[model samples]
Target: MTTVAAELWDGPASEPVLTTVRVPVPCVARPGTTLWHLDGPCRCFVGGPPPEFAPSTARG
Candidate 1:
């Protein structure tokens, strides 16, 4: 699992909410494997995809 920072926006009028979330990391070239690829837009947010994301340095 990998942690990342997601900036979610409810709407144009509302400010973006920054939060941390854990997503599954894909294996090395595994066939029929599925994982949350963080290279693009994030679908985990309720409102919509996050406009920005980055790797989190915080440790558990």
Candidate 2:
């Protein structure tokens, strides 16, 4: 259950309205909308170690 969408138009075709802003944000989209930065940025984990097999195959 993860959603991020924007199509809230209230002007056109003698007002053929359509509104959808599945929320969770500090709002800013009301002049011609389309803005999605949904749950973005908690991604940075780079530290590597694991791959060591050579002491003539480590087995006396």
Candidate 3:
């Protein structure tokens, strides 16, 4: 999996924080990253922005 450069901007302006991270690239609608939850690991995300990908129609 290709490592993806990412960041998380959270909180107010004065306390705005960004989490710079490297995650495996995700599928068109499924990112290759997951959140470690107390009740086992999870990968289902809704709002995380997806990366750019070359669609099949665009691929040679």
Candidate 4:
């Protein structure tokens, strides 16, 4: 588990407040690192970004 400070992106410039978030082990991955999840192996970027992977194509 990891604790991180996250900012709320609601409305224009007010006092910036950070929220503490605890991410479960499986859900957390290093930036630009590859790991196997329920969706197979993929390269994880950072912070709510989608993972990058190539779909497997069967050959006849």
**What lDDT tens digits, residue by residue, belong to model 4 across residues 1-60?**
333434555555775555544332332464444422333322255334454433346687
Candidate ranking (TM-score, best to worst): 3, 4, 2, 1
Stretches off by above 4 angstroms in model 2 are 14-22, 25-60
C-alpha lDDT (0 to 100) for residue 11 of candidate 1: 48
lDDT of each residue in 1-60, candidate 2, tens digit only: 244567888878887889776443221322233333243311123322222221243565
Model 1 residue runs over 4 Å out of place are: 14-22, 25-60
Task: Put down candidate 1 lDDT per residue, 1-60, tens digits, no spaces.
Answer: 334555555545565555455444343233244433454334444443433323566899
- For candidate 1, the per-residue lDDT at 13 reads 59
- Please list all clashing residue pairs in model 3, or write none if there are none: 26-32
Error of 4 at 60 (Å): 38
- TM-scores, all candidates, are 0.20, 0.22, 0.29, 0.23
Question: What total of clashing residue pairs does each candidate reach?
Answer: 0, 0, 1, 0
lDDT of 2 at 37: 29
Clashing pairs in 2: none
For candidate 3, write residues 1-60 as lDDT tens digits.
Answer: 433566789778889888766544344344453322222222345554444443344555
- Could you tell me which 10 consecutive residues in candidate 3 have the lowest summed lDDT? 33-42
Candidate 4 ranges beyond 4 A from true positions: 1-12, 26-60
lDDT of each: 0.44, 0.39, 0.45, 0.41
Error of 1 at 31 (Å): 20
